[model samples]
Target: MTFLHSFEPGGVERVALRLHEAWRAQGRDARLVMGRTAGAMKREWPDLNKGGLGYEILGSERIPSSGWETLWMIIHLPRAIRRIRPDVLFCAGNSYTIVAVMMRVLLGKACPPVVAKISNDLTRSDLPAPARPFYRLWLRIQGRMLDRLVGMAPPMRAEIGTLMGADNARIAVIDDPSLAEADIQRLAAARAEARAAPQAPGRRFIAIGRLAAQKNFGLLIDAFARMAGEHDRLAIIGEGAARRALEAQIERLGLADKVRLPGHVSPLDAELAAADALVLSSEYEGVPAVVAEALAAGLPVVATRCSVSMEDMLGGGRFGLLVPVGDAAALAGAMSDIAKLKFDETAARDQSRRFTVEIASHRYLALMEDLARA
Candidate 1:
C-alpha cells in the first residue's frame, strides 16, 4: 500500500501515480490509500478519482487545511494499515513520511517495513533560519524511523546519506519514474519535427508546476519581462493559491499579452511539441520530473540551480542552462541568450531515458521483492 496525502497535482503524487500504474501493469497488487479524495488530480485522473484504480479514501470530503489533513492522516493511518495489513507500506514522499513514522510507532510490531522516498531537496535552504534546525531534526527522525530510503538519482545518494546519516546499505538509488516509454517516444518525435523546420527568433517558453510560492512564478515573470522578445510568449501551466498573485504580477509588468497562465494542462505532448524551450524557475526541487520530461521531448531547458542533482541532471550545463537560484538578472540573461545556446537533441533524449517508468518500475519491483523476502 502507498500512502498519499491527497489527489493533489504535485510532483510526489505524480511519481506515486506513475509507479502505481506501472506496478499494476506488471501484475502486482498495488493499492493507493489517501488522506482525502480531493484536489485537481480528481479531474486529471478520473479513474483514480472514482476509486476505480484501487484507490481508498480515508476522508470522503476535502479538508480546507492541508496541515490539518496531514494531522488527520497521522492519527488514522495506523488503523488503516492494520486493517489492510499490506506486506510493506510505501511512504510516497517527504510530506507523507510523518504519517509513516506515526503509523510505525502506533502499530509497533504490526507495522510493515516502511520505504520512503526523498522527494524534495534535503537541504532546507528554502526554510527560514529558525526552521532549518527543526527540519534537520525531522530528517534525523526519518533516518531512524524508515526501514528503507530511496533517492531519485545517483547524485542524491550522497545527499540523503549525509543528511539522514544512513549508510549506502540502507539507501537505494532509483530513477525518478516521471515518464513512460510512450511519453518519451511521442514527445521526441514532435520535438524532432519542430527542430527540423525553419525556426523563428521569438521562442515560446513553457514552465510547468503548481502556481505556488515555491515555484516562484513571480521571479519567472520578472525575468521574462526583462528579456522576452516582441513575438516571444511564456506560458505557466498549473493551478494553486498563488494564481491571483501571479496573474497580478503579469498585469503589473504589462506582460498581459506575452504571458499566459493555463492551469493544469495534461498530456503535455502537444504543448511541448509546439514550444521552443522549457523554463523552470523553482526555488528548490528534487530531480524535477518536468526537467526529465522536457529532455525526453528534446527541448532546451533553463532552470534555477534548485537541487544538488541539478548539475548532474543538466550535465554541468552541457544539456541545459542552469542559473543561480533566485537571480532574476542571471535568468533573464540566460533566457535572452537561449537561442545561441547549443543543444544536442539526441544526447538530451538519451540522458532522459534513465528516468522512464519502465526502468524505475523494474528496480522498484526488485527492491520490494527483496524486502518481502527479508
Candidate 2:
C-alpha cells in the first residue's frame, strides 16, 4: 500500500499514484491509501475516484495536509494497516515515514517495514534559523527510525545520509515517474476539448506551481516584469491562497496584459507543450515532476538550482540554465538567454528517459521487494 496525505494530487501525489498503477499493471496487489478525500486536487485530478487502481480511504474526514495530521495518523494508522494487511507500508514522504517509524517504536513487531520516498532538499538549510534547529533534531530522530529510504534524486539521499544518519549504500535512488508518451497524448486530447487563453504573438513562457512561498512565483513575476517587454509573455498556471498576492504583484509590475494567470488548467502537460519554455522558480525541490514533464513534452527549461538533479536535468546547462534560488536578476537573465537558444524537441524528449514510468517502476519495485524481505 502507498500511503499519502492526498490533499493535493500535485507532483508527489501524482508520482505515488503512477507507481501504484504501475505495480498493479505488473500483476501485483498494489493500493493507494489516503488519509483524506475532500480537497481541490480530487476535483481537478479525479484519478483516485475513477476507481481503476485499488484504493481505500482511512475514514479521515478532516484535511490531512495541515495541522496535527501526523498525530492523527499515528493514532489511526495501526487499525487501517491491520485491516489492509499490506506486505510493506510505502510512505510517499517524510511525514508519512515519521508516522511509520513512531508506530514501529510503539507497536514493535505489529508494524510492517516502511519504505519512505524522499523528494526534496530536506536538510532545512533554506529554512529560517529558528526553525532549522527543530527540524534538524526531528529529522535526526526520524532518519534513524526509517527501515528504508528511497530518494527521487541524488540530493535526497545525501540529505538522508547527513541528516538522517542513514548509510549511503542503504539509500535507494529512484527518479520520479511522470509523463510517459501516452499521458501526453491524453493531455493533448484534453487540450482539444477547450480553447486556450489568448496570448500576445511572441515567445510565450510558462511557469507552473501553486502560488505559494515555496514556488517563489513572485520572483518569477519580478523577473518577467524586468524582461517581458522584449516580445516575451509569461503565463503562470495554478491556483492557491497567494492568488490575491500574485495578482497584486502582476498589477504592481504593470504586467496585467503581458502575463496570464490561467489558473490550474487540466492537461497541464499539453499546456506545457504549447509554450516555448518552462521556468521553474522554486525555492527548492528534488527532481520536480514539472521539470521531467517539460522535458518529455520537448519543452526546455530555466530553473533554480534548488536540487542536486537540476544540473543533470538541464543537460549540464546545455538544454537550459540553472540559477540561484530567489535571485530575480539571475533568473531573468537565464530566461532571456534560453528563449534565444534553440534545441531540437526530439533531443529534449530523449533526455527524460530515467523519469519514464516503466524504468522508475522497476527500480521502485526492486527496492520495495528487497526492503520487504529484510
Candidate 3:
C-alpha cells in the first residue's frame, strides 16, 4: 500500500504513482491510497489505474483543499490499512510520513510497518521563530515513528541521521524512482525540438518545479534581470500560488519580454534538454527530480546550494555551478558563466544515474520485504 496525501502533480505524487506502476511491472500488487481531494494530479491518476494495479480513493473531503485534507488523510488511513491489510505500507513524502507513523498510534498493532520516502530536508530554518524547536522535535518524532526512513543521497541520509541520532540508522538512502525510458525518450524529443527552436537570444535557459516560495523562483527572476543578455531568455515551468507575485516581479524587473512562465508541463525532459542550462534557485529540496532529469537529459545545471544533495549531485561544483542560497549576484554570475560551458552529455547523464527509479527499485524492494517480515 502506498499512502499519499492527494493526487497532486508535484514530485512526491509523481514518484508515488510511478513507484506503484514499477511494482506492477514486476508482477507485484501495489495500490495507491489517498483521499478524494481533487486537484491537477487527478487527471493523471486515471491513466496510472492500469488493470489489477488499481488504487483506492477513500473518504469524502472534510476540508477539500488546504493542509486540512492531509489531516483527514491521516485520520482515514488507519481504517483503510485495516481493510486492505497490506503487508508493508509505503509513505511517499514527508506529509505522508506523518500519516504512516500516526496509524500505529491511532490503530495500534493493526497497522502495518511503514516505509517513508523522505523527499525534503526540513530544518529549523524552515519554521517560524517560535516553531523552530518544535519542528526539530517533530523531526525526531518522524525518525522514531517510521519503520524505515529513505533518503535520496548519502549527504541527505547523513544530515537526517545527525538530526535524529540513533534512529538515523533506520534511515536508508534511495534515489527517487521517478523516471523511466519513456520519460527519457520524451526528453530526447524535447531536446530535438529545442535544438531547432526559433531565434531567441544569447541562450535558452529554463527552470522547472512549482512556483512557490520554497522553489525561490523569485530569486531566479532577480538574477535573470541582472543578467546582461538581451537575447537570453528564461522559461520557468510549473504553477502554484506564487504565479501572481512572480509575474509582478518579472514586470518589475522589466523582463516581461525576456522571461516566460509556461506553467507545469509534464515530461519536461525536452523543455529541460532544449535549454542551454537548467537553473535551480530553490531554498531547499529533497533530491529535486528536475535536476536529476535535466542531468540525465544532458542538460547542464546552475543551481543555488539549497541542499547537500544538490551539491553532492553536482559533484560539489564540478559538473555544474553552485552559488549560495538566495545570493542573486552570484547566481546570476554563475548562470552567465555556465551557459557558455559545453558539458559532456555522457558525463552529465552518468552523474544523474543515482536518482533514477530503475536503480532505486532494487534497494526499495529489499527493504520492503524485510520490513514486511518484521
Candidate 4:
C-alpha cells in the first residue's frame, strides 16, 4: 500500500499513481490510501475513481491547507494501515515521513516496514539560514525512521547517503518512472519527424509545473521579458495558488502577448513534440518528470541548478542548459542562446531510458519484497 496526502497535481502524486498502475498491470496487489480524494488529478485522471485499482480515503471533508491535510493524515493513517494490513508500507514523499515515524511509534512492532521515496532535494538552499540546521536534523531523523530510502536517480543516492547519514546498503537507486517504454518510443519517433520537417524561424518554449512559489514561474516570466524576441513565445503549463500573481506579472511586464498560461495540459508529449525547448525555473526539485519526458522526446532544456542531480540530468551542459537559481539575468541569457545550441537527439533519448516505468516497477517490487521477507 502507498500513502498520499491528496491527489494534488504534483510530480510526487502523479508518479505514485503511475507506479500503482504499473504494479497492478503486473498482477501485483497494490492499494492506495489518500487523506482526501480532491485535486486537479481527479479531473486529469478521471478513471482513477472508476475502480481499476482499489483505494481508501481517510477523510471526507475538503482540506483548506496543506498543514491541515498533513494533520489529517497524521491523525488517521495508522488506523487505515491497521485495517488494510499491507505487508510493506510505501511512504510516497517527504511530506509523509513524519506520519511514517508516528506509525512506528503508535503501532510499535505491529507497523509494517516503510520504504520511503526521497521526493525532493535533501539540500534545501531555499530555506532560511537558521531553518537549514533543523531541516538537516529532520533528515537524520528520517534515516532512523524509514526502513529503506529510495532515491529516483543514481546521483540522488549519493546525496541521500551523505545528508541522511544512512548507510549505502540502506539506500536504493531507482528511476523516476515518469514515462513508459512505449511512450518514450512514440515521442522519439515524433521528434525524428519534427526534425525532418521544415521548421519555423520563431521558437516556442514550453514550461511545465504547478503555478507555485517552488516553481519560480515569476522568475521565468521576468527572464523571458528581458530576452524574448517579438516573434518568440513562451507557454507555461499547469495551475496552482500562484496563478493570480503570475497573471499579474505577465500583464504588468507587457508579456501578455508573448507569454500564455495554459493551465494543466495532459499528454504533454504532444506539446513537447511541438516545441523547440523546455525551461525549468524551479527553486528546487528531485528529478523533475518534465525534464525526463522532455529528454525522452529529444527536447533540449534550460533549467536552474536547483538540485544536485541537475548536473547528471543535463549531462554537464551537453543535453541541456543549466542556469543559476533565482538569477533572472543568467536565465535570460541562456533563454536567448538556447535556439543556437544543437543537442544530440539520440544521446538525449538514450539518457531517458534510465527513467522508464517498466524498470522502476521491477526495482521497486524487488526491493519491497526483499524488505518484507527480512
lDDT tens string, model 1, 250-308?
98999999999989888788788778778999898888999999899988889998888
Would you estimate the TM-scores of all the predictions? 0.94, 0.89, 0.93, 0.94
TM-score, cand. 1: 0.94
Runs in model 1 lying further than 4 Å from the true structure: 43-46, 49-52, 62-67, 192-201
Quote the positional error of residue 300 for candidate 3 in Å.
0.8
Per-residue lDDT of 105 in model 4: 86
lDDT of 2 by residue, 1-374 (tens): 77776556467777777788778879888877677665565654456546555677766575444466567667777778788777788877654667778778877887787788876767545798999889888877766777788887665667678887888767888877876657655544443442355654677789887778889999999998877765678999888889999999999878888888978766676577568789999988877888877776667799998887788777777678889988999999988888666666567667776677888888888887887787
Q: Which number leads on lDDT?
A: 4
Q: How accurate is candidate 2 locally (lDDT)?
A: 0.76
lDDT per residue as tens, model 3, 6-33: 6566898888777777787887877777
Model 4 over residues 86-127: C-alpha lDDT tens digits?
999988888778989889888999999999998888898999
C-alpha lDDT (0 to 100) for residue 198 of candidate 3: 80
Model 3, residue pairs in steric clash: 177-357, 190-270, 201-231, 202-231, 238-263
Tell me the spans in candidate 2 whose CA falls farther than 4 Å from its real position. Answer: 40-51, 60-68, 184-200
Candidate 2 vs candidate 4: which has greater TM-score? 4
